[model samples]
Target: MDSQEDLKRCPVDFDHESRTHASNWPTEFRELRGKCPVAWTEKHGGYWVATRYQDVVAMAQDDATFSSFKTFDPHSGEVTGGITIPATPIPRGLPVESDRPDWNMFRTYLNRRFAPKAAEARRAKVRKYADSLLNRVIETGEIDLVNEFTGPVPAMTTMELMGLPLEEWREFADPLHEMVFTPKEAPEYPHVIAGVQWIFKRCIETFHQRKTEPLGDDLLSYFAHEKIDGRAVTEEEMLSFCNNIITGGVDTTTALTTHALVYLNEHPEDYRRLQEEPKLLPVAREEFVRFFTPIHGLARNVSRDVEMDGAKMEKGDRVYLAWSAANRDPEVFTDPETVDIARFPNRHIAFGAGMHRCIGSFMARVMFEEMMHVVMVRIPDYRTHPDRARRYTSVGTINGWVDMPTSFTPGPKIETGLVL
Candidate 1:
């Protein structure tokens, strides 16, 4: 700690992607934020960690200096870097992993489709999906909400949006859900990678099918024929685009809703308030997003030498923006740990910041809100069994639960009349 070299080397021996280090994130990140806001870590090829709120925001905003671009060779299973510490072996996550003109080019084409109005338009379908999911487990009084409810609703919604068969939501979502929390060394990791690869292949085939059929009001139809920069969109671009939507769309919202629901189960006072005052749902949703901060951190490749919070990072060095750490910063939130539903002027970057910010954020909100509404109104007395609950082994990629087992008094299904 005394030497200059140790100072830049991140004295704490930080490893953001480790399964063992996940629980100690708060304590570890607090130290880094206080002692070295831009500390460099030997983990993940020696990347800089930005913990302070303003610093993280500043870096995220300046995409030119802090790039999200990365290259991948699917055939060789080689990945240079793209938006995650120790980047995983996957194709580019679309505009999220693109820089400058490419980012703008992709984002502009899809922005209107994911805009607030578009999300609002999809509300009824989200509610229908939520109600239908609960209908499956209501009579049994036992439910693993992560799998049966939270996971499927968003997956189904995403499928419906893509003009894919709603029944195949599992086929599309299961691999993504599995790949996020599973460790790289696990035996199933290889299978998970292959499953992901299959998803791209399916997307290509689906896009081609859509090209020949009559165009519809969906993403697949648009990508099948739409031109970007006066040229036809390639299958690679289509795969990247679909990958970003499917990957980013389903699991993050599931995680947020799962955490929020579990929190509600533990804190009956908050639940009572939310139930009695239905108008507080929207505000409470934001508070949950801020507190949970799903999609916690992402990486950016340094394009040039820049000094951030007294630490100088050279060109090509990777930097991890600790959005989770920034969300809990005392300077930004009055009491960062506590979940206050009425939190005002809340500026947490749960969805991220700048040009590369999450494109499906509004849609995510709709999905979360509908699911939250359905649970509170229908399963009022549902009780989660903590002993049987399982959380993600690693929150490095996404802070979420593996499963949450719950029991409730068996109730009759409310006929929604919508055939799923």
Candidate 2:
């Protein structure tokens, strides 16, 4: 057993990379919660670490005090600040880093596209896409599930939702991946920035096209025409909003889908149960999000001096709402380490809480549930290639697999052709 002093310094740092890469982190986190629920560390210029479920919940809900704006230096802080982990530097004018009145306006415009009804309406299409992808994988006998199946599903779905050109899908996908996986200080930073600039330029062109030649059903058209505060949204605001949706919707969903499949493969009993009881799909999807927590944690800046969980936090201090740690906090969950699809009233913060909660959550859930349903029906006997499961390595904000190779008996091809 580690001493109290040892426990405080166990994780000592809260950067995404250290926690994700450290095999004993789960144990370290468990020990910290008991010894010092809100521990401080000097690693990333000092930040308070909240390991209890209630603390994270309170912090997430108290956005007034724990501001989400520019929290920490993404490069060296315990809490890798920014909207993401590993803290890729976002260009100025992006709405995610903005707060209050401005944030409200941007979220209002985005809400319409990601509303539950809109996502629910697309269920048929989402299911069809999943089925088609699974069919392709089955035909190949053995396949890299991440790149071959999971990656493309969300990429295609997000493109369709955003009304982006089909040809540019791959172009956008590359930058989104780099922004999440590659650290800003890495040698590839220049290349990643160039890719992001290219995509932003294309987004600008697309916004212009939508303005003149409206694609009535797409999100860009909606934003182009919608009035905020009884006035038109500026081009710059639209660009940032679009960028947020593109990156958030694409990479997060891809990581989630990849994790869901990997989790199901590792627990065949749970897989069989899900297949047998299809109605449990919704519950299972929520569990998967809770279990995998694709977006690990988000950063928040202290708006005012406040004391919390024994730590004297000053105004302007950066703090991390560790969703991964919070979700597994035994104070709120029983057997926090295990996967329980039936864990009802499971108030996990995987999608976060309060206003800034994931705008595309409904869409993500739809994609996940629909994909699970399609896979259960089409490839029920799937199994993962143990040696090829590739976990992402970076002090970043998502828990995902780079590649998940799988083997399964191919199901009979459907007579109705592929669904676009």
Over 4 Å off in model 1, which ranges? 1-10, 417-420
- Scored by CA lDDT, what does every candidate get? 0.86, 0.72
Among these predicted structures, which one has the highest lDDT? 1
Cα misplacement distance, residue 147 of candidate 2 (Å):
1.0
Every model: Cα RMSD to truth:
2.0, 4.4
Clashes of 1: 0
- Kindly give the stretch of ten consecutive residues in candidate 2 with the minimal lDDT sum: 77-86
| RMSD versus native structure for model 2 | 4.4
lDDT of 1 by residue, 1-420 (tens): 466464464445788877665778888878888888888778766888889999999999999999998898879998886898888776787878999888889899889989999999999999998998788888998899888889989889998888887777778778888888877789998998888777777778889998998878888889987888889888888888898898888899999999899899899999999999988888888889988888879999989988887787788788889899999899888988799987988999988988888899999999999998998878889887766887787778888888889888888887776544
In candidate 2, residue 336 scores what lDDT? 88
**Candidate 1 worst ten-residue window by lDDT:** 3-12
